[model samples]
Target: MSIERTPATPDPNWDRLVADLTAAPAEKPVGPVLQKTADVPVNRPDLLGDMPLTPEWVRTPAGWRTRAEVGKVNSVRAFRRWVRRQSTEHGHGAQVFRGMHRTFLWIQGTEGVQVATARREVQQAQGDYKTAKGHHGRRLIPGKEKYKRRAEMDKAFAGSVTAMSRYKAAQRDARTRRAARGALAAAAVAVPEGAGIYLIGGTGGVIATGSALLAFALIGRRTAGGELYHDHDVKFGDTLKLTDSMLNKIYRDAKVIGADEVVELLTPCTLTADGKAWEVTLDLPSGTPLKKALTAKTGVASALGVKVQQLHQAPGDREGRLQLRVSLHLPFTGKPDPGPLLDLNCINLWRAIPMGVNLRGQEVSTSWVERSGLFGGEPGAGKSAAANDLLLAAALDPTVALYLCDGKAGADLTPFEPIAAMHDTDGEPERLLEILEHIWTVEIPRRRALAKEHGSRKLTAAMAAKDPRVNLAVLLVDEWSSYGAAADRRVREEMERLLRLIVQQGRALGIITLCATQKPDADSVPSGIRDILSIRWAMRCLTPQASDTILGQGYAAAGHNAQDILKSQRGVGIYMDGEGAEPELTRGYYYDDDEVDLILGRAFELRAKAGTLPAGSVPLADQLRAVDDDDARVLAVLLDTFDAHLDGEGEPAEWLPGSVLVDALADAGTALSADSLGRLVVRTDDEKAKRPWLGSRVVGYPRSRVLITVRDRFGMGE
Candidate 1:
């Protein structure tokens, strides 16, 4: 039977419903109504409006309004603190004693005799030359005529023999007089036996002794030649005081400004309390550009009688102005202070890590997120030490997973092995390739998935806190030249390709790649990799070209030359963050082995607490057990393979190709593959690798090996 439809039931509500569905909602309540709605706190009152000022805010003073004020305050505090510490720790008493000792040495007539003898010899030589020149003009002919001229010159010199002899006699007499005078002075200062007790007991006698010592010290002070004694690293005296006239003279001598141009001193010359450096802000004369002064920094240093590295220049507030800082002593001469991480138990990877101090004595920090760094310098320039600072920072952060690849074969970065998720120090190209493959295929994809799941374009600390798998990852490759110098061409190419991919794509995924190499050549660190690295740290490179290679072209020309860095300035480097500004000179903090060990132990504990220890987020002991499981699996596969490939006489072959064993393991339903088996056998040569089963008879490339022993010597199995 057909169902009957109610066609007559056309309600007025149908038209109203259609109109309501099609009509736009009343224009979101214009103006104040909408503003009032938005202003209302919805579910989260903590995130709404300006906070009410509390008593704390009202009582707090309005701190420094400008950076200069803050810097000045901090500088004064640091300088005073440093002075107090140095005075106490360095022992000024010892310096005074040494100075007195040096004075005694000088007054013994030994130094005076030597000085007189040197002066006599120099004066006699000069007199003889002058006599010869006066008699027989300065010119000497060439060839046969040169020989004749020399003979004539000798005759003329000989003719002045009487005058030379007289000069020598006079010099000898003067030396004798000076020696007598020195002896008398020494005798005058000698303590009398009768007054020894009084000198030891009486304050007036003490004053007299001090006065005598001061007089001797002043007389004995030698500026040239290393005769003066310095008991401390920093000498407590003004090397050069920059007056307005001195500044003008320096500019004129350096040829940085025109002869008629005078520097307009915007600020008075201020000497640091430590007496090690002085700073001044000044405007260049009209038409004299600041670049001229910058380019002539070496000349300025020369005029100031200091090393080029001692002079630091920065742009002032306005154009054609400069802020000049002159260090009396070479920078980075003092022992480096320990870094902040030395005391901190944990750190946050999202914030900048205090890696170093700049030339201005201001803290220089580096943020790891979304940045890659290239550290290049000579072998002994402390590039490794600088890189270690960053590595230690990563270790302190529980959320950072460290992958250390030391091309120096564990000599440099072995300490990090305990906490690193993956560490390869032998610099086998294929091994590094496998690590990169794992990071690209596994770690990066895992982080990307987490980011997508959480609706984030980049991994955040919040996400890392929730999931350790999405935590920050750092890959540090030290001495990259070792890997680049791989014997296998294909392996090197593959590594470069994988490294480039990770560097370009892994940044947003919280993966940072840091490369350090002594060889700054293009072959060792290809421009392809170098250019992508946003941060560049160039230590004392051998040449400006090498500096340019590390810090990017034109950097050396722009006065950020790493080659100018003195060999003595270890750990000092030119740092560029790719911000298209002038690079900064920074000295990396010294982190010794003991400090590294302490940080590593703390890091291990922190990661344990956070459940982020890389080896499946388990404790170290569990991680070892997991490693043992793999070793056991490999042993079992080898034992089974030996039984499978037996001789006709029921004996296993003494040696077997690694490939043959790999196929047998695959057939036995084990995960061990040829690549894994090769790594096990090939890395046996590495002193750090734990391979009790793999014998020395294993041979061939990293991808293939010939195993020499498969049977147990204990006879537990056939």
Candidate 2:
């Protein structure tokens, strides 16, 4: 009864009261609050001092970045550097010696053991076969036996004999092969020793002894199951050992990837075939591109603890793939080695020219045939030295006719004057213009005609060998800007036009023009000429603009900036072979003054032997005066006869009779007859103008020199 009375007393405002308890409180009127909005400026100058403006690490002694950089430059690193220098200087020769020794030991030891083993196996097999044969013979019965028994015995005996014969033959064949190998090994050793002694005398004996000892050591180590050296032990310097973890760390530090992302290696990290660099191919994350990696080359180099120049990157086979090369050391830092042409007595222009070595420590050779090249750099940037690589190579080839125009007025190119067909070092723009015109009008046309006569569209080595007129012609213009800077504008314009024509049309005719300039600007090297040149070498420049002028427009943007080259690295340059080829770093081979002299001397001898020396070496008048008395008499009579037959213009008759010259010689009291004159003309013609005064009309007919040539020869010019 009490619970029913309490239930009946429920309030009507209970739902409203519960809703009011759950609902939000009503908004109260409040004054403006002092909230610091992001857009608002702080008002307290004292509290907002430079403390917040500067980074927190600036107030501390050192930041993480600074500390990391400092940690890398310590005594341990210095000691490592010292160790690397020592290994580079002293260990290379030792490694080479050890390698040679090992080779010899393996050849001798393995071959000897193989021969002995083969001989023993052959003897044992033969003995076993003979014993088996003897037993079979003893068991055989000759006359009386059941048919099946006799037949079975014969079949078994025959099968045994066949098997034994096969085994014996196989053993004998093995022994013969092993014996041949041993003989070859002995010959290999003997031949090198004999050649070494014959070539280097007593020094070769010491080398041979050292080689033999090394070989023994190598063989002993191999037999004892020990390796002479490991790849890691022989590493050049503190070369980075590339691994997945290391790569991931490098990528993260370089900012090439986010902290949560990892680069996927498309290929395993490995040493290059040259062993001068470590190569790896990898792919970036899904949204990343290869261009990001290439653009961040310096960052990656910093992460790898190397100079920016030591790291090179190229696009891989597909999108988002990067191929990276980390050089073990800075390339071309040491004194440059001599050129390959120094050892070669002669060279052929048809082959690629041994220009220099590239960044990969591999030799770089470029073909100049059907191509023109432009080399440019600032003064002392090895512009002339790079030109000399091609010039000296051309000089060594007797078949290449060299025409040099040295505008620098220096002796750098003077050594080649003796071998040059046309050499001008006076920096005279008029002379250069004349030379270019001659090349354009005379040389190009002559080469075209000769090529046509030989049924060839282009000049070839074979054609050059057969005909001297069809040889390759190379025109080198050092300091090409000197011509453009000439006082006369007309001369400069003509030169540029002729150069453009020569570069565009003369390549197929076996004419190559190599132009070099210290100032590689639009004014110095006109775009019309520079654009047609396929091969361009840009050495150290003052700006990327200058590099673009030499290599082509937009090349500097493509990461081939010659200005990036160190001033200390003189001959190093960016080489662009063609429009499609990527520019690469190359160090031109050094050619000092002494080396140039030697090369010139050798070239002189080669040209002299080939009879390709320039005619300017001897004066024509002097040559004419040096003729024998009989030749002089015949020449005098021929000159007189030509004078009598000359037209009013003083031109010699197109066709003159041998009899007429002979009659004149007789009148001059010469004993030479008409037949003798004909024979003399034929004989002198075969000598390729041994006597410059002598001229011929038909094959058998003798003709006289023109009036001007006669006057010039006799020094009778006005």
Candidate 3:
């Protein structure tokens, strides 16, 4: 269909000039005009002067129809409005389409001006070259001076030709980038806002349904000069375009903020980009280190309208350049795209473990064959997920032996009991003590012997692959605070000491310690051991103090702020792999339970295929049954806390109240609740347990029976 419209001015030269330099709009008819004629009456008076009339009315070619007849002819404006409405319904989102149209127009205007400017300069150079060539044959004033005059004109002509050639080359280079200009003009990444539909069910239930992934298709260019378009409704692998203005805004806002505080920063350089980051390279003021400007990362972030943790700075020395990587909305959207489980499918143990992602959405992984790492953050900050990345890495490697612990009451690590050589989750001091003892006594000594046998100072994956006897051992503690929370005082301290020893001495033996905790403070994880963990990952923290506690003493002051990460940014964090390097922005891989289980299943198959899976070993249930055998820890606590006098008024009392025993146990660093003591001393349901083990039914352990048990077990008696 065609519409009456004013014709656009013919600009054949300009149109052809920009044809390849910009993305053309989709083919469509001229847009319709929305005049006031669309408004009309649908009904009319029953009669004019008592004339009969029907109920329908509309515009017609013959005349204005009354209430009686309807025909094909209708209001031209109404028909055009309907066409426009349908086009809009089928087009790209209204706001996005408009924004794209404006951006494309702007690009076209700028490119055309650039071409014209080059052409005009070339024309001027061509005129100069012609003048120089024409003057080369000027007549000589005398027979002797003829050759000298001709030589001077020849040199001038040569200079003009060179100038003209340079101008022509520049114009040619611009003409060659027509397709790149088209791609650049079409680049865009803003997602349309989604709508929330509340659905009410029976029993007055309501639910809102929508997916951020469904808001729009992901758009990007995989390589330079590649196609520029959206991947049709991509669910995973989303990326955002980082523009120069967006980067400049971050730096400008930081300066505006710092200027108020008497801090002056150097002018920013041009912003550049690659697949990984939008890089801004500039120098700080003379004599001022880049670290000084980097310290205002939070200031820049607030100006950019993001949480502090979402911004990261990679500072250089005073003599070098400073780089500010602005993530903007990238971290908010770029994360583990929905997909299959990542696991033992990768053969390279060195790079197979997925840590998280860098600012550019690149995969960041760890090679933990002989490294010690500590992961820390507040509760629900994805600390466990980061730890799981390493665990999943080790699990996929058939030559790695696993030792896992979950200090919480829940069973996050229980799923791996089948593969682990030793595992604990209940925080039973005795159980953990034995597990540590086994590693310290049997595991370390064997690894040391294997290391000494080989001439290499450290055991590598190649060595482990060659010799099955010298496999890698991974010790992963899910919760560090649980150790300090143990009921047994000495056992609690011993657990901390053992973690330090493993990280300090286990490097050459191919043993690594990975401790994850919500509390990275000294009370939970001692500073002495924390420094030993070279690879530190600080996820979302609650405050600056907590952020500093996890990264280092001066980490937060240096501008790596993890406390500002939003809750929605679950698996994102700041990472420092070694000392003396600035922390970089990173996102941890987010693998759910089902995804983790998939890797677990594959790991089991790999272990079984390699003949490394546990075979002919005692069942886990059997191990639980043997936990109470001998009961040496109970006997020792009884002997230590025994009262010599009844209520301290008579000769030493052989038996004391259960309450006293509970307090004494806690003081001794052995956490035992009063209710648990009741179950042990006072008999409960006969169907539940055999009977109370203590001889005295009133409250605490009897001194006589305790002496007998101790004498029989440890050969010690009072």
Give the range where candidate 3 is weakest over 10 consecutive residues by summed lDDT.
29-38
C-alpha RMSD by candidate, in order: 28.5, 36.9, 27.9
Off by over 4 Å in 1: 1-239, 465-469, 616-718
| Candidate structures ordered by lDDT, highest first | 2, 1, 3
Model 2 segments beyond 4 Å from truth?
1-239, 272-275, 465-467, 618-718
Q: What C-alpha root-mean-square deviation, in Å, does candidate 1 show against the real structure?
A: 28.5
lDDT of 3 by residue, 330-440 (tens): 464544664223623735454446677777555666666667888888788888778777777777787788888777655678677777778887766667677777788
C-alpha TM-score for every candidate:
0.54, 0.55, 0.50
Q: Which candidate is the best by lDDT?
A: 2
Which residue pairs of candidate 1 clash? none
C-alpha RMSD (angstroms) for model 3: 27.9
The C-alpha lDDT values of all candidates are 0.68, 0.70, 0.59
- lDDT for model 3, please: 0.59
